[model samples]
Target: MKFEIIQPGSYAMIKATLTQGEAIKAESGAMVAMHPNLDVEGKVDGGMFGALKRAVLTGESLFFQTLKANRGAGEVFIAPAVPGDVTILELNGANHFFLQKQSFLASDDAIAIEAVSQGFFKGLLSGEGMFIQKATGKGSLAISSFGSIYKISLAPGQQYIVDNSHLVAWAGTVTYDVQKASSGWFSSVTSGEGLVCKVNGPGDVWFQSRNPGAFGSWIRQFIPSKG
Candidate 1:
């Protein structure tokens, strides 16, 4: 199977080419187009219990769309729910990644996505909730962001501060803690940063240029009140 990202920046989409019997799995409703020869099915990847956990804990769909070129070679087009950038990461079975909710787009059939707990405080303060999406196994995983995605490479023991809302995904080797953006809560709120993650690495972290939360707030200002 081969994956190509089209329209790289905003409004990005993925075009995946698969050989006979090869398959790819994507987030529900991600399919934009596909060849007639390809077959698509909805599957509860890790079974009913796992699906329920993913849905209840992480806010992901209960089922995934599995597309296969069973009859012959074919291509499928997949896109994210919102306008943004898309990126692909190749996993070799030796590493895994943790993704923010709704960041997952698609991945090879071999990749496995699950909802993993990131602890109560970390999840609550990080703005990613208590359960985060974890991708594992060997395959290509596609992730989407609300805006352009930026990669930050951190050396061992190096630390960086990131606004909680800007996080996309991070390598398994990276660790982070939720903290106030400034020394005091009032200052933090006044600074417009509020909570931030102090990420420590020996790994890479991906962040979106735009914050969906901030964008939603901006949009709300223009919406007329019902009263």
Candidate 2:
């Protein structure tokens, strides 16, 4: 299956095409447009949602969904139940809804919480932590990185260390610890643990390519360089 992210920033959308046997899950009214030959289904549950159950689609089911925040909710995350060719569309205004097939869980069991705000860098970091907790099964999620989106694998018996600045999202089942990276004596004296996030394996990790440091570098281009 192939995927393309159409918009990124406070609001994001992904446009994807599904070949035969591809599927994706969506909410009750999230479809902006879909293929003519695609089959659609509705979810019948309302339970606290994990990652996979959040989105759902059957084979070759063409559907589109939105992942924008509510009017006052600030930001929102759309985890459809079905997995397949998925596309994201940017919606206008604050209030928007879509039709989705709810067959996985009971409506009462579906997970619902106030949307998150992607306004600040720190807010994104916290969102990463929360997104992982909502992950289900062995599937890895592709999140938006500054330059591009990257994948994080959650393999057993292995550990991954990442800079907090670079982390986009992770699996909720994985445990994390704030550890210091060992630099030389002088380096260690000044930089402690380098502020790295040591993550246990059996889960995936996502990182952002461009960071605050990179942004600074880009902004510095206009400054006069002195030898």
Candidate 3:
């Protein structure tokens, strides 16, 4: 698949062209436009139960739509529901990623999507929730982010702290933990900063320039609550 990221930052979209017999699987309803001759089929991504677990745990679509250029060649336009940026990454053998829930937009059929349990403390306090999305295998994966995406390639024993709201994904090759943003409880409360993620690596970490949760909080004040 060939891809071009249009509208690079906020309100981003992807324009992809596929060769004959090539296929891409995307979150259901991710298609904004496509060629008339393309074959688009909706099917359970992993398996019926696997799809259910991913939906219930990670908030991803239960079914994925496979787009194929069966007739000859085709093109598709894809965009996430959020007004954010999108990135297409190529995965190598067994190169897995621990992605924020619902960050995945599309990928080649070679990718395997699963729900990963983040455990109790990290799950509840971290912005990523208890169960997160994991993508494995070798293929091209498209990920969407709240704003611009930033990357940090870590050296051995390099550690970085990030506000959970700003994180998009990290290599499974890194070791990480989620904890309070401040050293003390009082500071954590007064700072208005919530839990954070600490990643130690020889791999890479990706972050978003904006925080959707913080943006929501600001917008929520103006939104009238239900009676």
- Find the candidate with the highest lDDT and give its number: 1
**How many clashes does each candidate structure show, in the order listed?**
0, 57, 0
* Residues 1-29 of candidate 3: C-alpha lDDT, one tens digit per residue: 88788888888998889999989998899
**Better lDDT candidate (2, 3):** 3
Q: Write the per-residue lDDT of candidate 2 for residues 37-128, one digit (tens) a residue.
A: 45545543323332233333211122223232222222222323332222222222322212112211111111231122223433334223
Highest TM-score: give the candidate number: 1
Tell me the TM-score of each prediction against the true structure.
Answer: 0.97, 0.40, 0.95
Using TM-score as the measure, what is the rank order of every candidate, best first? 1, 3, 2
**Candidate 1: regions farther than 4 A off:** none
TM-score of 3: 0.95
TM-score of 1: 0.97
Task: Rank all candidate structures by their lDDT, best first, as comma-separated numbers.
Answer: 1, 3, 2
Which candidate, 1 or 3, would have the higher TM-score against the true structure? 1
